[model samples]
Target: MASGPSDTRVLVVTTGGDAAGEESDVASSLSAHLPGQTVVRSSSTAAEYLRELGPTVDCVVAVGADADVVWTISETDPSIPLVVYGEEVLYTHVDAVIPSTASIDDLVARVQTEVSESRETNHLEEVNAKLTALSRYAKQITGCETVHDVCDRTVEATHDALDFDFCVLAFVEGDQIVPCCSTLPMDAERPIDLGEGVAGRTLETGEPQVVADMQSDPDATFKEREFRSVVSVPVGDRGVLQVVADEADAYDEQDVEFLEILAGYTNEALARLERETALRDERDRFHAFFEALPVPVAYVEAERSGEASVREINAAYERTFPQAADALGEDAADAFPTTGERRLVSDRLRDADPADQQIERSVREAGVEPFTVVLVPLERIGLSASGYLVYVPGTVPSDETRTGYSS
Candidate 1:
């Protein structure tokens, strides 16, 4: 969507002096540079006038006659940015401070810049509003819990946010368009492998294609009578953001940009969701060790005897030693009821080489199963010494270790 208005109805306040003529002329000239019915609210005292006009005005162009006026206006509102239009200009307070005699081109450019910034701010607010609306749909997306959820949400949000008719989000599937999400007319199949769709072609080209009329255009692939316009915006350098609309020439530069922004949001959120999914998978796999094994599967760190304590131990350890969960972050001796077991492990760790050397040994502790630890130094594997892997007999099965070598 093209962002909200700027350079529109601006209340111009010429403060610190009674220069009505100067302020009016300046406001008139600046207002003329912009399009549409421009309203110029001229005043001598800006602080009082802005209070009167309130938030109905878009921006305030203040012509500060002296240095003191800049401070006064700046302190009073600061929300209505002051554009100094006098010989003696104060640089500190206003959004932009420039002398009135400065090049007309420069003045116009700054005004355009402010307009552009306002547009960006409006665009961001719109996106925020969309996200707020999408929060209610979180449960729907969350329930899906796959990449499919992300795709569905993307289409639903885009359709609602931008008021577009048909939205299609497709992922890469070799040479095909694997439809992940869509607000198409009817019940659409998931994982669309139709290689001939516009989405797939867009992904193959790695560029967005804007077709105003599919019926007239030979490049577009669709029931031309069904949709008049289409925009195939590529996502994350790979995926596709295919938007079809009923209006002829519906996809413009603005549409492309807005869809691109939506794609960017989808990419970021999907990446985060993917990472979270991976973490959950890792956690599930980590717990699976207790299914068939002898020793308790505990991840332990070889903490410095005096500097640190036991950082973490797994559920297997908690099962083997009923108190293992509560023992975390405590000194090994404090963690285990037996002092000899703690001394043996701590001493071995304290004297052990930094290299991840396998130390296979039988140990007996109170309320715990027989344990054999594979003291693999994690720092060698680019992982901080979170801990070592403890394989207790009947709790964790044994796996081969590459005797001693770093990649």
Candidate 2:
């Protein structure tokens, strides 16, 4: 069996007749085979001893102990490996049972094997728990709506999820990598060059870089020279996410993998923000053009209720028909409260084609003279939503136009 790590702690519990002698013999045998290992001999019951030592005990060896004691130890701490070294036939819960006739070497080898396997199992459990937490953090990062929010959450995840002390998220701005957010205060004016440091190298190669000992690395270019280890992963082509520590070899391949997962989440959030920003810019441009037109214009949308509603009206439209300002969000039929005028406007908009043709018709609102209105289909322009634009020419003399509509 493998000797395993030297830090293993074995608790030898001796019960029944010859307790002192049994404890001494077991301690000596374990110490002889496993050098630098800790052996604690206890005359107390198995459950009591385990309760006192808690998780500090890696393995327990019971000498001349009964089935009740072995069962109690298993119930107290199932994680602690139990080895019963008595001659009694034990149907109890125990990791291994050695015959009383067995030699000292057999006992030592069994304890070593159990210790090694126990450590491996515990390490795997810890890693799996950390990964589960990182998965939850990734969901929150993806839901972030802005680039700054994404960077903040990314840095927070480094500390909360991965347990890193220092982290920085930097984006490419021109030829320099600008720090967007960091756990430590960073100089915003003096950013890192796109090809200078560990983060720079990650961005350049589009891969993760792990430096076990930055002090000894010739390519290390971070301002904080006190940090001895660093891991940098690229956030797509947009930026790099980096974490550092004061201890050398603080990060392993597992640490790099976790950071890469977080970087991927940040990339998704940034991409979402980019798309939203582009859509907002497009809508702003469209609104500017709508307002700049000299003629009065009103945007109408077909609601789910099978009625056309006036969604928006330009400044010129509001000024020309002052009563129409209150008509915003009202049905088109109510906006033009003239006899048969509602059907006249709705039919023109419904029949308007996508070929960019403007259908002209004369319509009269209550208390206002008849005016020529143009129905232009807005679906072809790809506005944020499908709608129609109502354009009224400025042909009515100022004196002939009414200031308000009559109910």
Candidate 3:
């Protein structure tokens, strides 16, 4: 990637009364040392030289040029290395300041070194820019909350930051690969299955597909025949990403590496979204089940002092135990008809080891039917509650009549 003499172009700007003689000497010496380089000589001030700047100009070698002009050029395009050949040593912005009386060999050597360094600096800057762009794209994809949003953003970011004529994000749905999002609209949405096109083949093998010239390769069966360069990267187990360009050898291993990083981000985001959705669904199902139960149920917790308290109660519990309707945050001992039963329940739960600990006992009150009560321990699940209390009507059942409560 190094720039040779043919690729180098030097803009020599001459200034002051003594500039004419010095500019000729400098230009002649540069031509003799670097024969193939294009050396353009111009006499102008800082403002005039700015207008003379062109795309082909690689480096600016100022001979007796005004100090202000040199500074202006350096500031304007810092990438363009500035070499000043003059007597006054300002040390402002030039990359190399050679004395007016310096030998031609010394001047040429300094210019050559500055040009090479400038080329290296420019290459590093380009690489840093790409890395910054990739980082920004990753952040954008992570912000998306849904699978569809992530897929869409992946296409947009890849197209904007990398070299590609078209891109696609397809997910595996059932036995077919479905197009979830793409950079361009298709005449007809074509679905690919296992062992079919590049995308499908990549998905089936769980590996990346890179085709240098899709038209010439028999294995390349992608719908788009115009694309010469193609890449398909699997997005975990969910899907695959495909990018295409019209020119031969448009992409290389480095391009594939970059796209793979993007694919990894997309997969992680999709997995996170799926997990969160599952949790939300499970929580809703549990809430509905608790609300619809016919029997009285209450969640009771044990404190460090060995006291039991009611943490939550269902609608049925509120109706059957009207006196303890406002039992939330209240001591279970106070909510119950008597203190003895609450203490007995807490001690039994504290001593139990299993998560689904259950005990049955008869209830005798001043009024109403003598109900059978059951307490279930919930310690194994890491909940704060010691267990839940359930009340079943009638006398305590025999072994054949009893049905164990499932945790």
Candidate 1 C-alpha lDDT tens digits along 323-362: 5677677766676454334543454444334222222332
Instruction: Note the residue pairs that clash in candidate 3.
Output: none
Tell me how far the alpha carbon of residue 96 in candidate 2 is from the true structure, in angstroms, after superposition: 3.5
Cα miss at 65, model 1 (Å)?
A: 31
Per-prediction backbone clash count: 14, 0, 0
Q: For model 3, what is the error of residue 41's alpha carbon versus the real structure, in angstroms, after optimal superposition?
A: 5.5
Cα RMSD (Å) per model?
A: 10.2, 7.1, 6.7
For each candidate, the alpha-carbon lDDT, in order, equals 0.59, 0.73, 0.70
Q: Rank the candidates by lDDT, best first.
A: 2, 3, 1
lDDT of 3 by residue, 57-166 (tens): 66777787776667666776666777888755475677888887888789788888877787778767765776678788888888789877898788887877764558
lDDT of 3 at 337: 59
Q: How should the candidates be ordered by TM-score, best one leading?
A: 2, 3, 1
Worst window of 10 by summed lDDT in candidate 3: 354-363
Top candidate on TM-score is 2
Q: Residue 317 in model 1: shift from native, Å? A: 6.2
Give me the displacement of residue 301 in model 3, in angstroms: 11
Off by over 4 Å in 3: 1-58, 63-68, 85-89, 98-140, 159-165, 221-225, 252-254, 299-315, 323-407
- Candidate achieving higher TM-score, 2 or 3: 2
User: In model 1, where is the ten-residue run with the lowest total lDDT?
Assistant: 354-363
- In candidate 3 the C-alpha lDDT for residue 243 amounts to 84
